[model samples]
Target: MNGLDLGVVGNGTIAGLVNSVGNYQWLCLPRFDGEPVFNKLLGGGGQFDIWMDGLVSRSQSYDTNTAILRTRLEAEDGAVMEIIDFAPRFETRGRVFRPASIVRRFHVVSGTPRIRITLTPETDWGDRKLPAVRGVNHIRFNDGELAFRVTTDAPVSYVLSGTSFLLEQDVSFILGADESLTDTVDVITLDWEERTRQYWTKWARSLAVPYEWQEAAIRAAITLKLCVFEETGGIVAALTTSIPEHEGSERNWDYRFCWIRDAYFTVTALNRLSAMGTLEHYMRWVRNIVAQSKGGHIQPVYGIGLESDLTEEYATHLPGFRHTGPVRRGNQAAEHIQHDVYGQVVLGVSQSFFDSRLISRPGIAEFRQLEPVGERAFAVHDTPDAGIWEFRTIAEVHTSSAIMCWAACDRLSKIAAHLGLPDRATYWSERAAIIHKTILEKAWNPKVGAFTASFGGDTLDASVLLMAEIGFVPASDERYVATVDAIDSTLREGNHVYRYKTEDDFGRPKTAFTACTFWHIDALYRVGRVEESREMFESVLSSRNHVGLLSEDFDPSTGDLWGNFPQTYCMVGIINSAALLSKPWSEVI
Candidate 1:
């Protein structure tokens, strides 16, 4: 019965997903793409759990305006325990001290609560068990190149043997590097917790969130921030990988790497909140990728460290999420000719040229480098590729890809104008106009009375909603409005929105693409259906997990979240919808 009802904690360097019951179910050590030390979320054998005797009820939530999570467990005998989980993140010395670590503090609320600690870590995607070497105050887990230590004040014997013990005093567990602690566990953990709490609260206070749904906006912003790899500025699509889009669909794919499209939306959402740090870092990452590409073809996805060859493979050793097989380790989309990526890269990096708050601004050199990307986008605007959906067998000149290509040219023109290069601006603007005209004629199917997924196709695609969103089409235009209505009547199922109705590589999409639903909501608001948009937005907001987190997909009938845990796409949707649907601060305050 394990589900996506999970809470995430990270320090920007590494992240861990804790299930509702206070188990460290999914954690990648050292870095986001490092080995999975706790893989039970994918039905593997590694986990860290706190079991209370005679448990009756349990609930989980984040500490206000922080990445810290609190799971409250109450026993039938009136014993209560609260476990505080976070990866320590705060400024230390002259730099930020965000290490690859997780801290768990156990506080007994009532009576003498008896609890048992289970800490088991595996390696090689749960294919091998790590050997533990116990010290007086710590246990070092070693698995070849992978090694970390757990320092605890609780008895090592009790933890190792899983023996039930009375929790009369507050305890602490620090899972981090192999180095020993310098101070007492209680002293250092308390200090780290307070400092981390202050750090997050201070960071949250800086966000310019919407008047309404402020809490959802802040939580989504924080979760999106957690997905960032501070070391390289690359943002992961999600923390854990291989979770099926729908159970038994075998649509599982690894989302550990950074996708240009996902990162574009992620930065755009965070940018709305005035959380510019992530954008700054991500722009740096994008710059690195662009520089390495040397104006050549750019992959849709890459490792956080900018490793490009993300060859997809199945980890036959471990069973998939919910016992579905084929736990994929890498994404094959890295090899896909996802032309939309050209636009995504330009769009994601465009903020650097416009935003003056950034430490490093893009100048003529950067503009010169980006011109080649714009050239490629214009060249491939009408070509066939995998599309945004990344269909395996079919190749179509997807409308989404074409529009994004248009976006690349449009943004490049604006950037060129900003740089005072009128000739270059005119060149890019003219190319954008050509792409725009082509899409208007080819992508719009008069038979369906809407813009289809691809040229000359009669099928409806949720991504077409982005036409109005990206300003390729006006919201008030009859064609865009009719497209929205057509999709509303076809692909939308109540509050949920499917990406498309047609079967492709998979038989058919069985669950709602969480982000597409948000796009639909945004489109409704833009089309002046304010009340309906707000109602639908609320419905999707209610679908979030207990800790206000969302996955990539959702089961409309069962209300179960599926796909990757803590999906960046879904988190971005929450922020974008809240920003669009929320009332203005002048009206509210």
Candidate 2:
């Protein structure tokens, strides 16, 4: 349960759908930015949501491999209405972004089920549920309260439930159209479930990555699309309101905002499929933010809509779901200076420079590959800020952060030369040397043969796996193997990888991070453990949700999900690991 109320269904834990009653009961809408119209999830206290409209059952499915959700709601009256919610994919736009928006289509099937949709809107973070009042075709909660209104052209009157009631559960329900114009005389035109299903089928055919784990990859690709912010080119990490680091613990935080690092990982996730459109659009936002002399010193996070003014406020008016307290909206972490994020962004785009798919974007396609990489690396070479941990504690120079810096410049320089970009060989070569010097000179303790989190921290870090994977050291390098062996011996709790012990460990996280798990796989592959690498890859994939979706963390003890939901980082990890495994299978089978 969460701070938002109502019984849970999808929770975006997997694909979501409501029972019957045509209640978009599970959606947080307007634009994933809007209030919870029917958030009977997060526990059910925020908005008044229930399936009390009628007596019947409901079921749902995805539109092929796409993020389109279609729910079939049946009525005791023998009437059926299919409710479809999808934010249409864009092939025409100059940029590739499918934000947290929804397009809902409702149509009737058989008997007339008394259709009821409650419009109890809440403001802020589900704090105030505005009372509903209807005037003309516009159903507004403007009785001294207004978040949004339900407007339609047809005649839907107040029914026994005190919510909008339709006499028939017909396909005639136009999502945002007036009921009077849409019903009987038919003022608006709309397609049924058939058209919606076809739309997804066509898009699934658009993906070109058809290797060993393509199905799982496609699901993640579609999930990443939903995580994107539509208006701006930003991509938020996940869409849900609350997921505790440990359930019911005070560790719950909202992740509806964008992290530069997370978005970068998303671009890399789609790299194999030539999803360059997504990266170009994302970089537009990146350029705008970094260039702006904003108050926050180029903070690591932003609002999905580029509304950088995200404030953290708890809704005091609404009761929390299952009584979980401090339900919040907007991320407070946005204000923090995360130095490591820069490396992640640089690394992701650098990976793109090597991506041949990027060869299609006009000037961007004709874009020079390597020189820009060096220039960007030069831009932040010595500027100290928050490291990758995004630690709430004081900032320090972390080894992993330094490694990414070296790796990013190294990879991007190669990509730039390969893609016909400015090479800046002297600058890149010298910078690479300096970065390498900085990392080894300041980050290592020779006695341990493992990297530390910061310049001198003694704790063994889960992040040390990056040493070999990022090419900071050769896979066979003694120090690199020692670091991996150290992690295998100490950092792992069964398969769970703790990012150092934290207060969030109500006990340690149950399952190893899916991303870190893949990190292990890649390390195993790099060090010549092909069978071990494949086994590790399979173990991580086995933890996916029923539909193959993954999250930021998992509980190894009970094998439940933790951290954020539908984590882009973990998905990208899967893509990287799967692609790596494909090479071996191609050699053999």
Candidates in order have lDDT scores of 0.92, 0.59
Best by TM-score: 1
TM-score of each: 0.99, 0.79
- What's the C-alpha lDDT at position 579 in model 1? 95
Over 355-446, each residue of candidate 2 has an lDDT whose tens digit, in order, gives 45554332344233323434555455455556665655556666776676676567655554555556444446567778888877776777
Estimate candidate 2's RMSD in Å. Answer: 5.3
lDDT of 1 at 512: 92
Q: How many clashes (backbone N, Cα, C below 3 Å) per candidate?
A: 0, 39
